[model samples]
Target chain A: MDLLERFAKGDDAAFEALFRQFEREVYGWILRIVRDPAAAEDLTVETFWRIYKARARFDPQAPFGAWARRIATNLAIDHLRCRRSEQELPEQLGAPGAPNPALQREAREQIQRAFRRLPAKLQAAATLAFIEEKSYDEISDALGVSIGAVRLRMFRAVRILRKEFNRMGLKP
Target chain B: MTKLENHDDVRAILKKGFPRIRAADEEPRRDLWPAMLRKLDAHALRQRVPWYDWALLGALAGTLAFFPTSILLFMYHL
Candidate 1:
């Protein structure tokens, strides 16, 4: 049987192997979405816990990475939604320059600010498309939306981000 | 400009700006294995059924007792 099947049968070793394989990727993906290292860790653990609990329903034929990513993405999106009331966008972007660590961090923060301004679904779509570099089909599966919807969300997200960046006097 | 023209402008800007955002591949700041293990252990413990579920069960039992013939009908449908 496959790893998922073994896990479904309560094989602890199989579960451990799966966790070790996907832990970093899952955690990174969550961190990108939530922009909180602490919350990302908690959500990563919760994703794995969910996977373990729902192992019996897992289709062995499906790609494990995609399935795990979908779970993590959904959890991250839900977390973002819950914390929506408290989120704030930074007012300015640093001037453009050669790639330095400080410049990179500033750009990242600005991107995050622009990102936070989007609706949760739009954020998910844009993140999957731009940050995760996922294809439309992959993003559709991850976000549980049609490809058309994903495209629309991406479009809207970009539009909003551009407008916000313009207001901040940042040439996007 | 038309909406389509605005959309094109936004797309152009996004193409330029997106790459400026850093790609993160960092490990979690702290180890999470112990916490996860604790969560797993907690999950292994028996879960308490909610009061509403218990009430629903009692109602079903009472209904079955009052109309035992319904059991035969349910079995037939199954």
Candidate 2:
């Protein structure tokens, strides 16, 4: 039986298998959008839980990967909205005694900080387009926006990120 | 004078500025399944109504019983 068929039949093993398959991509997509490991992890688990809860609603004809990603992306967007209202930012990226090489850590942190500074929609667009390397059509479908809007958001996000990078004295 | 446009400069800068951190290979610092289980339990718990809400419901029923005309008024407003 297919994964969704097995899932709908209440097969725990199939569910676990599906989780293992999509977990990394879902987590990475959420992380790129939220820029917080903790929040991303929480959202990743929540996404899986949601998927499990809504298994019966899963359309067998639709691609499971896209469906799972849409769920993850929506949760990430909701988390960002809630965090923005609370004025909570991610913890400073390069805290003291970090594990990664100093230069790499700093670069990552800088990029994350710049990403966080963007408006939530722009951040989502940039994360999907550049970080996830999703095509515009895929992004539009995942984000539930028109393709034109996706292009506009991506353009605006790139412009803003470029400006922010230049201001930080980061050169190509 | 208008500043000279540098489209290629910005494009190059963006290409370099994109972070190379790959989320695909990176493992979360902590296992999240336990927390997920806790959340599931919490959700299940939330489906059960509390006694206070039951009491309030009882009170509403009592009020409605004592005042039958209020039902029409409530229905009208709704």
Among all windows of 10 consecutive residues in model 2 chain A, the one with the lowest summed lDDT is: A88-97
**Which one wins on DockQ?**
1
TM-score for the A chain of candidate 1: 0.79
The interface RMSD values of the models, given in order, are 5.3, 6.6
Query: Which DockQ-derived CAPRI band holds candidate 1?
Result: incorrect
lDDT of 2 at B2: 13
Give per-residue CA lDDT, model 2, range B1-78, as digits (tens). Answer: 011133345444433445545745457777676776787677767668787897998997998899999999878988
| Tens digit per residue, CA lDDT, model 1, A27-112 | 98787677677889999999999998888888877888889989998999999887654456567666544377787567656655
Per candidate, native contacts kept equal: 0.34, 0.27
Best by the TM-score measure: 1
Give model 2's share of reference contacts.
Answer: 0.27
The candidates' DockQ values read 0.18, 0.16
lDDT of each: 0.74, 0.72
